[model samples]
Target: MIQVAAAIIEDEQGRILIARRKPGKSQAGMWEFPGGKIEQGELADDCLRRELMEEMEIEIDPYAFFGVNDHHYGATHIRLIAYRARYVSGTITLTDHDEYRWITARELTAFTFAPADVKFVEMLHSSKPRLNE
Candidate 1:
């Protein structure tokens, strides 16, 4: 299974950041918590930090372990590790995503998320994420 890292990044208002998969990328147009694959021998936290920096050019303070999900898309198996993070700084940039949004947990269901990220959205619904508040 391939390991991946994902972050539930919250801005000062407690709105979580979600990104749309860019055109030509896997799962293009689907929304997801911001993050990327964990490189070999890389720590999960480090991978998350690197992904946020590389993909969106934003800095975050990841503070707690969120959860994990195992998913399969055809032949690819993914183990997604997630963390709760607070937005630290930087303008929201999109290199890997076509768009980005900061929304409340209640608003998550409105967007169609990638299969691997569906569980995270469900979890947020079961209980709101009070990241900034």
Candidate 2:
């Protein structure tokens, strides 16, 4: 089983960030929340922070733990822990993705996301607001 961490990074404007995977990468050309697999002994939040920095050259405040989704593709079983993150700092210099976009809930359906990510997206859409208005 492979353990992965993903962030549903949202800005103050209520837009969520999504990235399109670069060609030749795993699940290439598919869109996903910015994150990666967790290494040994690394906390899930720490892994997510490191991945966001490495992949997008940005820092994230992973203050909220959303939920987890378990998925299996072929012989690999993946456990994806999704977090509700707020943007902290740094410019997004796409190191691994072909493109990035800040999207609204309705815009989410237009992209072709990985099967695993699609589940989380649906969950996010159905979930209540994390911040109090």
In lDDT terms, which candidate is top? Answer: 1
Candidate 1 lDDT score at position 132? 50
Candidate 1 global CA lDDT score? 0.91
What C-alpha lDDT, on a 0 to 100 scale, does residue 85 get in candidate 1? 96
Residue 23's lDDT in candidate 1 = 91
lDDT of 2 at 131: 51
The alpha-carbon deviation from the true structure for residue 70 of candidate 2, after best TM-score superposition, in angstroms, is 1.0
Clashes of each: 0, 0
Question: Candidate 2: how many backbone clashes?
Answer: 0
Q: Residue-wise lDDT of candidate 2 within 1-133, one digit each (tens)?
A: 9999999898888889999999888899999998999999998899999999999999999988888889999999999999989999999999889899998766788899998888888876776654532
lDDT of 1 by residue, 12-78 (tens): 7888899999999989989999888899899888998899999889898889999999999999999
The CA lDDT of each predicted structure is: 0.91, 0.89
Model 2 residue 64 CA deviation in Å? 0.9
What TM-score would you give candidate 2 relative to the actual structure? 0.92
Least accurate stretch of 10 residues (summed lDDT) in model 1?
A: 124-133
